[model samples]
Target: MFSKILVANRGEIAIRVFRACREMGIATVAVYSETDRDALHPKMADEAYNLGDGPAADNYLNIEKILQVAKESGAEAIHPGYGFLAENAPFARACDEAGVVFIGPPASAIDAMGSKTRARELMKEAGVPIVPGTTEAVDTVEDAMRIAKDEIGFPVAVKASGGGGGKGFRVALTEDELQGAFEGASREGEKFFSDPTVYLERYLPNPRHVEVQVLADKHGNVIHLGERDCSIQRRHQKVIEEAPAPEWVVDEETRERIGKIGVDAAKAVDYVGAGTIEGLFSSDTNEYFFLEMNTRVQVEHCVTEMVTGIDIVKQGIKAAAGEELDYQQEDVVLRGHAIECRINAENAARNFAPAPGKVGSYKEPTGPGVRVDSGLEAGGEVSPMYDPMVSKLIVWDADREQATKRMIRALDEYLIEGLTTLIPFHKTLLQTEEWAKGDTCKELLEDKEWLKSTAPAEAPKPVVEDEDEETAESKYLVEVSGKRFDVRVVGPALSAGVVAAPANGAAPAAGGGRKPKRGERKGGAAGGPDLVESPLQGNMWKVLVEQGQSVEEGQLICIIEAMKMENEITAPKAGVVEELHVKEGEPIQTGAPIAKIVAAAAE
Candidate 1:
């Protein structure tokens, strides 16, 4: 066992790894950027170091800074939790060169599986079924056209060779749309991953997003821990995940088959530690095709842990230390159904736009089979510089129905303030007929009206602040022997506070309270319907239209990259484009008019 391990990550995942290390009696170290000095992950570590300032590139993604911290903190190993440098092959190699263990698969494995095209080729060689398309990179739009028109037919997916988590991915449903999708995927690939190569895949419209969790050791032992159904997603990224695949989507025989496929995939790559083999599984056909491999602990690993009763993090650490298999394939058994909801600071009504702001009244639900992996408190802020995920709410029960009910209860009990969250969305989603029948709820997700229904019905009651500071603290103060002492209670009370409870028994809505302190935004000037306003805060990654350019109704006008997701702002009506306001690579805010349109003949 290692004496100390440095977690090269932040937020909930960092806290998760720390907890596992503590249970295993290993000292933990944490590194944080200047913006995250007050964050929870650093506060929980046995040792903490500052990793410079600003965005991830200056901090978490800075391999040298992270390595320096590890060396200074005397950490024996580095655990790159599932983001930032988690899948970076060079980081893994750097850890090895620094004489510190990288608690993951070897760099070779990461390199082998990191590129989507290369992974597809390897899977085909290993006899694992993959989505039909190019097994090689298509460098030009011309090649993409040829591949889509002749090789794979229509509805082809243009995927960045190094993409994951929905970035650098686009779908072209027709020949006319192929060039745009190709260029978009390549651009995002170059920007995010520094890899401009892309590949085509036969897009499986509305296929179930299933993945198998595999654990392997350096000593040639690999095993699968069943499957997780991650079909509930927005913007092609998962928001909810459930274990054992609902039993209806995956039968016992198919489960065994997919389990073997997962094991085989790991073996093909000579993989080590914990990894996930994501696939597009068809319930109607009882067949699964390989999608890609995530060479790190997944975001939804908590649901897997709840059912399997396996401390995957601890096992991963042991494997890195050259430990043997603790359990054979026969010993692994899933006990119950588990579901995980990614609680993000986002507004579902506004197309799941990121709503980064400070938290006010934060409280987690507590009960049997309910777990919250979070990093924020009542006063914490969800920074727009990172992913929108604030926490992961997981629950378990003997069956999917019971698990659904428990999740509903847990969601109702969770209270977050100051900003919007997906709680309202999750509440409505779990109660729908689609969930009961194991449907993906694609229609509802695509329906704008249906999404609006998931928004909070009302804001909380106003909390007036008129009393003087001394006067407010006077009542909370207690003094002996005529000695006056100051004690203060600020903000709204947990109950009967500013918040108004929802009619569906869900958590109270945000955006109500007395003026106390931190976190405010710069409102952007908005115009009428003809003006295309930015729906949320983000960077203007690209502007697709120029002044006086004619555009059709609902045509793409701009792409706003917010919280690692690209939101395409479109024309509201058929007209001549004018008043172009957004600049490329500039910060944009909600209601900001990026462009405008008038009568086409007027131009």
Candidate 2:
């Protein structure tokens, strides 16, 4: 067992690993960029190091710097908590060379499964089912066109060989869209993964996203915890996940089969530690096809832990220390249903755009069957420099129905002021007809009108804007027994006709600063109906329209990259583009003018 372990990540995942290490009587080390100097993860660790300021490449993704920190802190192992360098084979090998244990699979295993194409090839040879697609990388658009038409057919998926978590993946519904999808996938692959290789696959229209969690050791002992249904997603990323996939879609028999498939895939690469085998499961045929493998702890692992009564992080660390797995296939069991909703700093009403900013009055729910995994606290900031996930709300119950009800209760109790979050979205989705019937809810997720209906509820403005005309009660400080107290005095003040006045709708607090307001729209006000405004803050990724160009109603005008998700801004009406206000690669603010569209009727 390692005396000290360093977590090479941030936010909730880092805290998660730290908590596990504490339980195992191990000291924890934390590293942070200057941007995260005061982050909760570092505050919770036994030792901390500063990686300087800048983007992830200069800090989180710098293998050498992290290794240096580990050695300086006397850490024996490093845990790359998902995302940045979790699955980077070179990072794992570097840890080996540095004589520090990497609490994940070997570099050989990561190399075997890191590339989507290579994983497909290996899975096929290992008798593990794979999605029907080209096994080899398609370098040129010409080659991709031929493969899509001659082999896969229309509605083909162009995916980066090195991509996961929905990045560098695109779809071509028809011949005209193929070239763009091909190039886009290749470009994103090179930019994100340093690989321009992409492959083709037949896109399943409404397949459910299911993943199985497996733990393996170097001693050849492997076992699966269970499966998680992650069908509820936005922009190909999961927003909600539940363990022991719904019985209606995946029965006991199907669960056992997929569980075995997961074990087989892990065995094929000699994988060790915690890993996830993501697959596209068909609700119709009850068949499963492998998507890819995540080589580290997952963001939604809490739901699985809640149901399985197993500590996945502890097992991963034990495996890295050359210990045999404690469980066999028969020993693993799932007790109850658990659901996790990702509480992100996003606005579902405006297409789930990222809403990163400081949070105020943060309050997480408590009581039985409810858990919150978060790194944020009151007055903490949700930096746009990182992912939008502010926290994860996980709830467990005897069954799916009760679990859902518990989740809703927890959501209602949870409060995060000063920024928009997905609480409303989760509350809305859980009660939908599709969710109740175990459907994938694909149509609902893609429906703009339905998404708009999930916007955060706001309190009505007080009718009397002038507080002077109001007779509302006011409080004043009064000393009592050497203690300070606030007392409300309204009787004589009302009779004396005392004028009242205040800037905020709610009276000021005892500390003097105003209580953080909710649903407050900042920046320039949106003007005329013909003028489209940016609904959220982000950088302009692409501007699809030119000034004076004609467009149909709801046509995509531009893409905004916020908190790592691309949001499409569309035309509000059929009109001619009179002017474009935002340029590509520039920062935009919420309510900032986007474009001016003169309605066709006026023209």
Candidate 3:
């Protein structure tokens, strides 16, 4: 076994690899960028090295820097924990040249699978059921149009050869849309992957995104760890994944057959360590076609781990160390159903825009059969440089039905204040009848009405009483800097306050309080107190207000960059800016005072 391994990744995955290494009594070396100097993975590892600037190209993806870190740390092996340089063939070969073990499949396998078109050709030659599409790269729009007509026919997808995620992909329903899609896909491909080569594929309109997880050892022993149904997706990105694929849809016979196919594909590549064979399953014809093989651990690997009770990371490391298969194909057993929900820092209501900010209250769900693989803490800033996935929530149950219920309950308990999250969206998805019935496909993207219906109901409006008795009532005056604002409090304890004044000058009656209810006040005549405004949670990227400055509504007060993305903090209403409590680049917890915005009196 290796004494020390360098984890060439960041975020949750790096932490995950570190945990596995720790359990095996192997020391871990973490590499971080300038932005991630205070990242969780660096703190968790035994030794850490700087990978340069925050940009992926300058830091995580820089092969020379990663190799330097490995050499400096005296790491025997380098584990590319998915994303960044994980599937880069050159990185693997470089590790070999540097006399360091690469904890993944052979470089040859990565090269073959690195390009989608090449992988399709190899899979076809290996007698795997490949999707009907062009086996070669199409350089021009004319070539794409010709191939769409001659080979794939109508409704063809133009995809980047080296593209992953949902980028560099465009679907053309007709001939008129072919040229535009080709150009757009090519542009994105070149920008993202530095590869402009694009390919065409026959679009399977309503196919389920099903994939089989496989593990192999150096001795050519390969085994499939069952299938995961990832039909629930948005923008071609999987949102929810379930293991064993709901016995009714996959059945016992189909499972065995698919498992065998997965194993064969892995063996064909002489693959070692953990990988996944993703496929698109047509429910109408019950036909499955090979999509692409992910050459590294998948984001949804947790679901399979829950069902198999196996530590995949440990197995991956052991295999990379040239170990033999410890268990036979028959020895592998599937237990209860498992499901995983990728919790991202995005606003589901706003077209799923990335909502990167400070994590004010980062609370994860915990219970029987519930597990959370996260790299965030209470005050961790969600940076915008990396993937928006904050964490993964995986739950297990005896059956799919129970698993769904448990997942919903877990999501309810999962709280991430300060920024918007997809928790409500996940909760809505769990309650969907089609989801519960296992009726999902890629076509779910076209159903905007169905998607909108799953959103949570808006909060109820607060009711206000008459303003006459409000003047005589005791009012609390909270001073935020030099600005003073008047607010009516119902209870004796100021913490019991709830509703802020609505735009209509009506003081809404407070509902439930931390303590008993008190009387209400009218206006500034009632001697209202002033209060300071602060960011919900996140590092204080900048302080926009000074001691005394008149500010209007919708003014950009500060900018908080979390999870590698920037969030603009705006003024709630027209007020005079008073005291600025925070400075730039300072980490602030949830409810930390940011500035004081004193409300203007009625004219």
Candidate maximizing lDDT:
1
lDDT against the true structure, each candidate: 0.89, 0.88, 0.81
* TM-score between candidate 2 and the true structure: 0.86
Residue-level error in angstroms, candidate 1, position 515: 17
- Model 3 lDDT per residue over 351-449, tens place: 455656667667899999999999887767677667688899999999999999999999989977665667888888788777878988334445666
Clashing pairs in 1: none
Clashes of each: 0, 0, 22
How far residue 479's Cα lies from its native spot in candidate 1, in Å, is 36
Give the range where candidate 1 is weakest over 10 consecutive residues by summed lDDT. 466-475
Q: TM-scores, in order shown?
A: 0.88, 0.86, 0.76
Q: Output the lDDT of residue 101, model 2.
A: 95
Error of 3 at 247 (Å): 1.6
Off by over 4 Å in 1: 459-531, 548-550, 576-578, 596-603
